[model samples]
Target: MLDACYDTSVVQSAVDLANTLKPVRGEDFLESVGQLHDFLDDHPALGPVKPSEPAEQHAAGARWSLTEEDLAEVRSVRETVRAVLERASTDAAGAVALVNDGLRRSRATPVLRVGDGGWRTEVVSGTDRCSAHLAAAMFGALASVIATLGPNRLGACAGPNCRGTFVDLSRNGSKQYCTRACAHRVSVAAYRSRNNPG
Candidate 1:
């Protein structure tokens, strides 16, 4: 089990990485090395996060140097993370297996670090490969969510034509759509259908 106060930003980073390739739109935002760099820039939590107190840090992987190989490997990790999000609600056991296998391949190790603020746990890879670091951070975050909350908290959006993945961190855990816009769009469409039944 991971820390009870797992970093939600890391969990969101996993979802953001998985959502970079939109299945319903058939659009891939992470197709190039530059895009991969952009992703790293946007989600710094996916990279080697520097602990506030380095002496207490157990492990922090190497800095990312993006490449074609790195892009390919990160995309592969994305597939596994996406699969977990899409399947966890229905097949919790299968999702657990996917996360476990990916974490094993990435050599993910969870470390408890004492920072200026307090103590927190982070997952890091043993190698310098950017993809492995990403896999460790993202897959480990998903695993933490499954262990903390139920596996059903991770899922795909219910909005029509949108396959966006998300972790339902809400207190009630009733999230069906990825965003407020998606939920409102769906609600309005249903209302229109009821009013203009023809």
Candidate 2:
């Protein structure tokens, strides 16, 4: 479980979860979460979540279990999120559509919760609260990333072989690679190109 706040790891986890749905990789939910944590740690935002009025707790109830079928549906929604994020023109309308598409795919119902002295925006489903929690966590994480990295900075990796995206917080805005390895690869390629001149 993750706090519905601007925790970098949580956002990364949400993004990873979104990526897990791709056919290229096997379904590994826990692995996705772990990868997300690593990514968030690597890309630190200079800001933190501001404290707000305490959110009201919902009625205590039995925890929801995510069945395999439910997990599959969640994965599908994640794919939609990934598509929206990867697309070149992802506007507010696209974001909302992606979120709603996830809800529709999962058959999740919308519920209001009091958080940070205000209503938390989330979609819920009976007997599947975990899915709702995951969705909410993702929503919070995405919001944090957007606030921290403006649109221009949230870019896909420039590496030709990599499909990963990153929120570039670099001071000089010179972030062309997602990781040091990618940078090294690109640099070596450039050096070879210059030497070969072919």
Q: CA lDDT of 133 in candidate 1?
A: 79
Off by over 4 Å in 2: 1-5, 19-65, 88-93, 96-127, 169-174
Prediction-by-prediction clash tally = 0, 0
Cα TM-score of candidate 2: 0.56
Winning candidate number (lDDT) = 1
**Per-residue lDDT value at 17 in model 1:** 89
lDDT of candidate 1 at residue 124, scale 0 to 100: 82
User: What value of lDDT does candidate 2 attain over all alpha carbons?
Assistant: 0.49
| Weakest lDDT window of 10 consecutive positions for candidate 2 | 45-54
Superposed on all Cα atoms, model 1 deviates from the true structure by an RMSD in Å of 3.6
Would you list the clashing residue pairs of candidate 1? none
List all candidate RMSDs to the true structure: 3.6, 8.2
lDDT of each: 0.83, 0.49
